[model samples]
Target: MHATVSDHRSDVAVLHLRGELDADTAGQLSAALAGLLERPVPRIVVDLTGLKFCDSVGLSAFITSKQVISARGGWLSFAGANPFLAQLMETVGLSRYFAIFPEVDDAIAAAQI
Candidate 1:
């Protein structure tokens, strides 16, 4: 998987992810996200439109990130996860734990809030 992190605004950062998010790539994502969380950014929007697949490890990464950000008084959200990933999130009962948006604009708006 390929992940790029960009500053969306003053307090919002966007992480654009492409390709599969599995065990191997999940670690990379985690490390990158850890760096983001360590910063002062208050919100992070993960754009998963280009993501092709995700495994349990990826789900763990998302959940862990959410917890860490929440503890830091920030938020972690997802955008454009596609239908399959959406279903998977629901199946795993993680839909309620995250703010999933249909578009990057919506996610950005939420992040700014």
Candidate 2:
């Protein structure tokens, strides 16, 4: 998987991810998230529009990042997840932990609030 980050505003960071997020690529996601969390921005929106697949490792990455961000009084959100992945998240009982949006703009706006 590939992770690219951009600043939506002074306080929110947007991470756009593409490709499959599995064991081999989970570390990349983790590192990218870690880098973002290290910055001054406290709100994060992870865009999964281009992501084609995600395994348990990817789920772990998301959960761990949320924990780290929340511990620092930050917030993490998600956007552009496909139906299958969305169902997977709900089935796995992870939907409660994240605010998922249909588009990146919506997520960014919510994070700003």
Candidate 3:
């Protein structure tokens, strides 16, 4: 998987991820998220439209990222998850822990709210 991060605003960081997010790529995601936390941004939005697959490791990375953000009194959300990935998250009872959106704009708006 590949990850790119952009600062949309002073308090929000947008991360665009592409390819598969399995065990091999989960570490990259974790590192990216950790770098984001080092910044002054208070919120994070992960765009997953380009993501084709995700595994348990990927899910763990997401959970870890959320925990990091929450510890800083911030929030982390995901956008553009495909049906398969979405189902996986639901089946794992992680849907409630994350704010999922069908569009990046919606995710950004939700994060700001």
Candidate 4:
């Protein structure tokens, strides 16, 4: 997968992901997200519009990320997840740990608050 990290604002960061997120690419994504946690409270929105597939390892990465971010007093959210991914998240219980938004704008708006 290709992960691009951008600073949305002073307090928010946006991560745009493309392709597939699996064991081979999970480390790349994890490294990308690690850089955004320099601040005191990191608010991140992961844009998954271009993501095609996410394996269990990839899902585990997200769950682990949520734990780390939360422990650091920050928030990690998801945006633009396709219907299948949405259902997968629900099926695997990721929906409980993450606040999924319909789009990047919605997640950004909510994060800003």
Residue-by-residue lDDT tens digits, candidate 2, 1-113? 89999987788888999999999999999889888889653689889899989999999988988887888899988899999888988999888989999999999888656
Instruction: Kindly give the stretch of ten consecutive residues in candidate 1 with the minimal lDDT sum.
Output: 34-43
Compute the lDDT for candidate 4. 0.89
How well does each candidate superpose onto the true structure, as a TM-score? 0.94, 0.94, 0.93, 0.94
Once fitted onto the true fold, the runs of candidate 2 whose alpha carbons sit more than 4 angstroms away are: none
Score each candidate by Cα lDDT: 0.88, 0.88, 0.86, 0.89
- Give me candidate 2's TM-score against the actual structure: 0.94
Residue 62 lDDT (model 3):
85
What's the lDDT for residue 21 in model 2? 95
Output the number of the lDDT-best candidate. Answer: 4
Per-residue lDDT of model 3, residues 1-113, tens digit only: 99999877678888999999998888899888888887653588899899999999999888877887788788888889899988988899888998889988898877655
Clashing pairs in 3: none
**Clash count, one per candidate:** 0, 0, 0, 0
lDDT of 1 by residue, 1-113 (tens): 99999887788888999999999898889887978989763589899999999999999988888887888898888899899999998899888888889998899987545
The Cα error of candidate 2 at residue 108, in Å, is 0.9
- Write down the RMSD of all candidates, one decimal each: 1.1, 1.1, 1.2, 1.0
Candidate with the larger lDDT of 2 and 4: 4
Record all residue pairs in model 4 with backbone atoms less than 3 Å apart, i.e. clashing: none
Which ranges in model 3 have alpha carbons more than 4 Å from their true place? none
Task: Count backbone clashes in candidate 3.
Answer: 0
Clashing pairs in 1: none
